[model samples]
Target chain A: MIPLSDVTPSALNNVTTQFILLHMARANKEPGLGAATCLALVADETAAVHFQFWGSECDSFRPGDIIRLTNGIFSYSGNRNALVLRAGKRGRIEKVGEFTMNYVETPNISEIKWVPEGASGRYVPESVVSPYSRIFPPLR
Target chain B: MAENLLRPQPYLAENPLERTLRESFDTNRRILDPPFPLSIPTPEEYLCLTRAILYSILTEGRTRGIRLKYLHAIVVDGYASFTALTASVVDELFERLLDDAKEQIVWIAGEMVEVGAQGFGDLLVSLLRQVVGGDYGDGNMWLCFEEASLFLRKWSALLEEDGEGRSALCCGFYCFLRLLGDHCRTRWSGDERLSALRQLEIDFCTKMLKEQFSLCMNVGRDLIRMLQDLVHVPEFHEIWKDLVLNPGAFGCPLFSDISQIYRIRTPSRYFLLRLTPEMERQMRFLLTNLKLGGQKRHQAWFWNKFLGTNPERETLVIDLIRFVCCAHHPTKEVLHSDIIPRWAVIGWLLKCCRKNYVEANAKLALFYDWLFFDERVDKVMNIEPALLLMVCSLPQYVAITDSLLEFLLLLVDNYDVDRMALITRGVLTSFDVLTRSGVVPSSDALTSAEGISPPLKERLGALLLRKEDHSAEAHAID
Candidate 1:
């Protein structure tokens, strides 16, 4: 369990955190995976991130749901062309609560660019792309 | 197959309480019936049996009889933890409960009452809270009917036992009295079941007021507020006459005048009887967590989820108003922080009202405390928000300021003509304490607000300028 701000682009299914879903886009089908995927803006008290929901996860969550992600991966996906947070093959997400958790929309970690550090292959935030999600804007 | 206690939603983790009960039931499945083990189990096994029994009773409809028998056989702690766990299920999972599961919960509540289980009163109160005040949907109305029937059926069982039973009866009286105001005045009165439910509620409330007047008095002045709405009903009309014209008829010597009811501040818990736990949670979250400017989204969510889809829900605004004013008092840190104040949330709720009656009732709820405020007993917090709301809405939303001030004045003059002086004194003291405590800088802001109409200002000015005649006023009321 960690704050969303601590998550960096990673291939390993190790990021564990909780966030409230702020905004969600309509689900789209991925031909290769034969499953539906939805893009959503999720946040915690610390920071916001772009969360990708795969398969039934798309229909299982909605705006205002507080979700807990276990062993999630935060890395760039070529299809979305963005650094997104997701429950990869080895990870899972569950709806924990709703409407009570505090959240921030700014400092979207997914919008920040990341670069791999020397030989360690660990990624670090390189430069800012946007302070908030470009795909799903903040509520007025 | 047994039904799931709560409606299954995708990707949601299992609730630990349900898991405990389910696992226990699974572990004890073969032994749940007949030929009970002759051995007295350890404390841990006792708890496991209780959980298993509760789970079986809730989910296993066919074997409910046998499961209840098992529960009775292993009773310890006066069924305290068992009833409390049932209440948690009601409070937490009720909204998602399948229809059959809901029926089972109500049936078990009746069983709990029959035996006078230790915490059955609280279980009944929790069920009562789940019956939304203004909801007219079939499910909501069905709950209303079932709970009303249960209260009527279990009236004696509720009264025969200890203090918890009596207090739970008080809670029922408060809830049904308030609910009857809705049930009697709705479009669904044409429906037979709703009509039957209305009659049951009226029967229970009228019986409480007529046969058990002393217990009804324990609910305080809000009793009159709820009763006033039902004056059109013939039964309550007779009760009202006795309340006002013949106080002796109630048979309580101390409660001779209605002012006595007015003087005793309605305890905060009575206000909570009207709101669902889910609604209470969202309101508390908005007031305690969100900042003033950022509340729009949460308010939108609250509105859409609770108030948006139905016109009848507009009436819930009144309950929300009273709940916010009487029930949820913020701490100094939350109050001092950028967190939204109670008045702001109230102001938004006022604007949410789509119907005239709802708006008026909401305003009355907001100012009901001010009509009978006693600094000795009533916290200034209750009256503080109305004046602050009036002051804050000035200049730009001048109409809000004007209407609220006009309503306050109207209430002083006509809320109860016979008790005008009491109400006037209450209003004056409310404004006085609000300013004196620096909740607002001065009363001049309201009295001198340019947007306020002239005649209304004069009435307010006259009321403010009137000298204190404590002895004379007390004599007049007495």
Candidate 2:
């Protein structure tokens, strides 16, 4: 089992690896049953699958935490990419000590960007380029 | 580790989730980049959207404004939407924000009054049709009626000077009156709460009619003429009676004039009795001008000729009463009760029954015969619950259990036992205590003569005890 951080997206393209991360995702209790944690994660470079942990595994993981996994199987469940890890493979999993979750945070245009001194536009001139430019760079 | 980790090198990822998110961002970018597209909408466009939402809500359709609480929030926060605010939301917001400030209410009132009568009239007519035609349930009907009534009331007050406004107001008032009449005739039945609401409607119509009498009389004569066609409708009779009897409630002088006009032209004795003093004077004045003799002579002649000798007029009054009171056709014995005269009881029962049913007419005739003729007649005999039975049934009567009870009691008294078992079971279900007492007179008399009295009471008592036990068990479980 390769460590998740060491497994690059390209290497994950068609290869299966066991990964355990604190599978941080929205958790909801199933009707008349135990809690479930839903995690959206990439299994390989070409595909991403969501993994759901039920019962004890759901309780064992915390969001925004890292755990290592061994023998995690990959499959697509409905529209989501998924990983399934069983208790027999629990010993292979380890919580990584250092990991930081990444969130997309766009700066407020009015606050972060400065327009040229002589700029004239309908909106208050901010140095920040349009969010569109950041989303889709010029073809060149 | 600290410097490199804190200032991590940027990495690029190509993945489906990231791709979708990236695409979404691209779309937002495209939407925003163009001409820095003006976020501010034109005033006209904004007004149009608000109007659309207002119309949707008013017409009982779904609105985004309601789902999002956009209307309430916008009004509360004083946030200007791209469109003008809907009248309904504005009204609601005003009530909340200004707490019914007289000045704001007046401004709203002015705006409502300015709306074209044609548009307002169409809206009111459509609403009235829905309510009267039973297109909506009671709660929705109440809401629609309330909104239309309040709107018209305010508009009427503010735009009395405008001919179009006055006409629209009258049209709306007429529709409401018709709705009330229909409610009384069809849906209300023995529902006391609804009956009370109908009474309030009557009061409202009376008030509106008084305030807009001339306009109503002018436009209303035509409307009344049309309504006259529905006079045979039970609802029409109910509302018409209220309108006639309580002319002052409408605050309309023209109602009196119209009432007198209806009296002279139609010579309905019911309408004649409902005339106010002013109406009487107006009729006399009109008659005098027409050389039908001076006011007093015409009045005496009118009363003597139409009121005194006109059996048809009397019959009409009796019919109106019969139509109004008896939920079921009154038995002859009930019609003869000393507390109410035979004619009056027959009239009341006629009013109570649905207008178009053949059974209603048949029942009315039966009641008439029972009231006016000797009780010994076969049809009338045994038609009333024995005095003791009636007394025993008084509590149920006051409770207004169901119309079936009244019908059963009347039928049982008349010795119609073909369905006695069914009636007995219904009574048992409705009044456990009374059923257990085993004191239903007609049934008791029949059973006693058959020599099954003691056993019958025991059976009844046992059945009631079992039922009570079951009920207790159910209650405990609940």
Candidate 3:
């Protein structure tokens, strides 16, 4: 059992791990069973993840519930920035002891450093191909 | 110098009214911001101010002309900023001014007619701008149309006398007629007003036909045809048919001549909803004509005249077919039976099936098995029977040979028997071929499937013998 603190939303690869401290919940309708609720969770760190529980299971888990997941699948939802937990069979929910939870403050806007001229941004760097040294072709 | 000194300066008038008017007009040179502070000036005040300015202009007509230009500027600025002079007030001023200067208006119209085609066209456009810009309420706007139409009729009469761009002017005249006709159709009420408007429209259209036979001959033809098609509505059909067929007797074109006629048969919340069933039928007929095999000349003619360039007819056909296929209740039956051909309908459905790839692949497997295995249909179009059979056998192949055996087992346990059977067959067929060719290693397959589905305890008994046999076979081969 991995601790919730150690699992980053960005690095959540195991399908069968419990996720606590979910912040957002939205109600969506599945085709056959009218309305179901989806929960968007992020671990104490800043990385974001989404998990969906449908039909009878949706009624069992609320937004603040501490849920333990079993037998689920991780798939990319839209972009690579987030992963979705889909088709989970078993979820054991435990009541949170306290209503109040401490959250880390986001970094101050003024404190962030700008990149230097040659430094690359967050994406992985690729080697330049010979004829494609420049990112864009010159216009006529 | 003596002549300049002797020139009467109206600003020097001693009367208190004149003095105050001059002072306020001069001081108010700068643009006024609303709330304009001043009380709403009466029509008499406007008239008095206009007269004083005109009097000053006449005294020094040459140099004073330059100063009078500033009056125009001031009026424009005042109109823009003054909230007191509302639409009604502005409308009254225009009506009064036009009433006083009917002769001047006629003179301007005559000038336009004498100045040849381009000049006349420019003048007419300017007049239209002036009319639209005038603050006539929607009702009074129709009143202004009478004067405008009279002036246009007089101007159009000069077409034969002065040989010019008669065709272009005729087209412009036709547009003006349409605008006025639309206005009457929308705004006019009472039997008298309706009859008057209808008569005016008929007269203008007739004049246009007499002047240029092809200005919109087909439009009239279409209207006649539409009226004939509405034979189900006996009263309306008879009224329309009588008016259209006996043009000279009833003073209107035959309904057949009115192509693409949009009659406001019923009033709606926002607009008079235009119903043109005949026009829609004609368009569909034209589209079908273009789609017909061979007769490229007819298709080309239709495309050039009606369809315009690069018409997306193929996509349109596909959409129409899809619409029919997905329609509800009564509409579904009507579309399936009457609207599109069977071959075309099937083609469209196939296109949708291809676009929705996963659904298509699944359905295709089911359809192939159902058709061949159960002998459902005599023949399937476009796809070969042998390929269909091969695709259908995929799930069975996957079950025997794939290393992701646990996933398949889980699928069987979790899903209904029908779904499990379908997916299993698809996966098995693909895996069987791959296994036979030794494309996938037996060990890697087993490792990948582990822990993903079902408890090892539940499946361990059934797989023990096969696992041992595979391992022994591998050792023997190595």
The sequence of per-residue lDDT tens digits that candidate 3 reaches over residues B388-420 is 222222344433222223433454344334233
Ten residues in sequence with the least summed lDDT for candidate 2 chain B: B1-10
In the range B1-478, model 1's lDDT, one tens digit per residue, is 3346778888998888777778888887778888888788788998888878888877877788888888888887888988998899889888887787788889999999999899998999899989987788889889988988898898888889768878988899999998888887888878898888888889889889877888888898899888998999998998898888999988776778888998878889888888888889989999999988876767777887889878888889988998898899999999899999998899999999888877888899999999987788899988888988899898578899999999988898899999888887788778878888999998889778898898888888788887367436755655
Chain B TM-score against the true chain B, each candidate: 0.97, 0.31, 0.26
Off by over 4 Å in 3: A1-140, B1-107, B115-118, B126-148, B151-156, B161-165, B180-184, B191-198, B217-478
Report the candidate with higher DockQ, 1 versus 3: 1
Instruction: Give the lDDT of residue B197 in candidate 1.
Output: 85
lDDT, candidate 3, equals 0.34
Task: Return the top candidate by TM-score.
Answer: 1
DockQ of 2: 0.01
Q: Model 1 compared with the native: what TM-score? A: 0.95
Q: What is the interface RMSD of each candidate, in Å?
A: 1.2, 42.6, 38.4
Local lDDT at B58 for model 2: 31
Residue-wise lDDT of candidate 2 within A24-140, one digit each (tens)? 445576565444545433222122223445455655554333344454433332233222223232333344421222211223121223222445322223444443123222122
Off-target runs (Cα >4 Å) in candidate 1 are A30-34, A78-80, B1-3, B469-478
TM-score list, all predictions: 0.95, 0.26, 0.23
